[model samples]
Target: MPNLTITEMNNLKEELKKKGYKLTPQRRAIVDTIIENEGKHLTVEEIYDEVKKDCPEIGLATVYRTILLLEELQIVYKLDLNDGCSRYEMVHKDEIHRHHHLICTKCGSVIEVEGDLLENLEVKIEKQYNFKIKDHSVKFFGICQNCGE
Candidate 1:
């Protein structure tokens, strides 16, 4: 879990305001849970379960709606690992492109790969096809060390 600085929280609040949405208590709980569970790629049900601990009155529908709103605001993005579940992770402002993920097929674990590993390929494709590149997602599936061992 990554600790969100006060400034980051303020900026997120401002973003919500710009979009005509208030950072209500339920919404705040959802966001805090997401931040606290960074890299976990939690699904909506999982998020709801965690948030219900502190916000007993919070509904699953509210959690789902908040996640959709945050996704629309680019504060978070959905991650599909092809496991019949839609997970999500926070969007880092500093990242120009989404980072890659290494998925362990046997143990069902996800490891985030740091840095952009496709810059050269992107440049080449852009030049060859005269196309502009914006963003991309890459996932590598294989047996992890623990699974292999």
Candidate 2:
């Protein structure tokens, strides 16, 4: 992920405040985990385990609530890779509206593919079907190089 600018950081804080939310230490830690591990697509249990190392008093329920709140605020994007668990990643403020995913069926690894590969396709679909595509997500399932051997 690109480095976060001061303005973006301030805007996030302001937005939270506007929503009657405080930037508590727990919340900050959770956000940091998501940002630092950008494309890892971490699950709630994974996040809770990581946060607990630093904040022992934090509970699993608290982590779940924080993740749900972050998702609601658009600070993080929830991903469902058909892996039977919901994963999340930080939202890149200046990138394409969404990112694609490469799912390794053998090992269940997820690789993020950057760039909007569907711009032209979306335009064609919109014109042909008279549909306005607001948001889109794509996932390609295959065996990773490591697992293919």
Candidate 3:
């Protein structure tokens, strides 16, 4: 989990205010959970369960709605590992690029691959097709170490 500084939290609050959205407790709780579990690639149910630990009154619908709002604000990114559930991770503003995913088809485990694995490919594509790439997402599916045995 990435450590969120006070300034970063304030920036997120300011962003919400600028978008004409108030930072409600429920929304804050959801964001806190995501921040605390940065690289987990949590699903809606997983988020809901974590939020419930502190605020038992928090409902699943609230978690879903908050996630949508976060996604719209680009504070969180949605991921599809092709395992049926939609996973999410915090958007690290300090990072220059996003990471890739390694998914185990048999066990449904997702792993994060850091660094820009597509930099060379993006550059080649840009030079060949005259198209600039802003971002990309890749998911490699195969049997995990435990499952391969």
Candidate 4:
């Protein structure tokens, strides 16, 4: 539901320009597709399929390369569900750390947990180990409500 605002889009364009990367039509289409499917955590193929609807000439390799570039720019990050394929989601500037995920083992549905649920644990670990915690990713796999029902 957190789609990129117009201001965010402009900022992204500026960032790309600063990095000597042009936001070409194909790249824009790829970015728009990702923004439109923000919570879906789409794979490169899925992104290609959706982008193809708007840009029939777009290639799978192009999507793959663009995704890599976006990831490199920290505009997006890959989420591995331990399901073989890699999925991608946007990088929220406001997030101190990546949000957690609730993955349904039975139905394979994914739910995002927006709240940072590991703050206490992080504090304990930092105190115990004398290490600075930058960020973390947590995935809990279990039956979802629908599956439990």
Highest TM-score model number: 1
My TM-score estimates for the predictions, one after another, are 0.95, 0.91, 0.90, 0.93
lDDT of 1 by residue, 12-124 (tens): 88999999999898888898899899899999999999999999999999999999999999999999997999999999999999999999989999999999999999999
**Of 1 and 3, the candidate ranking higher by lDDT:** 1
lDDT of each: 0.93, 0.85, 0.86, 0.91
Off-target runs (Cα >4 Å) in candidate 4 are 1-4
lDDT winner between 2 and 4, please give it. 4
Candidate 2 lDDT over residue span 3-122, tens digit each: 356886787788789888887888888887777777789999999888888899999998999898888888888899998999998877776667999999899988888799999999
Candidate 3, superposed: residue stretches over 4 Å from native: 1-3
Least well predicted 10-residue stretch by lDDT in candidate 3: 1-10
Of candidates 2 and 1, the better by lDDT: 1
For model 1, what is the alpha-carbon lDDT of residue 137?
A: 98
Please give the ranking of all candidate structures by TM-score, highest first, separated by commas.
Answer: 1, 4, 2, 3
User: Model 2 shows how many backbone clashes?
Assistant: 0
Looking at model 1, the pairs that clash are none
Candidate 4, residue 86: CA error in Å?
Answer: 0.2
Over the stretch 1-149, how does candidate 4's per-residue lDDT look in tens digits? 23457898798899899889998988888888888898899999999999999899888999999999999999999999978999998899999999999999998999999889999999999999999999999999999999995
Residue pairs in collision within model 4: none
The per-candidate count of clashes, in order, stands at 0, 0, 0, 0
Off by over 4 Å in 2: 1-5
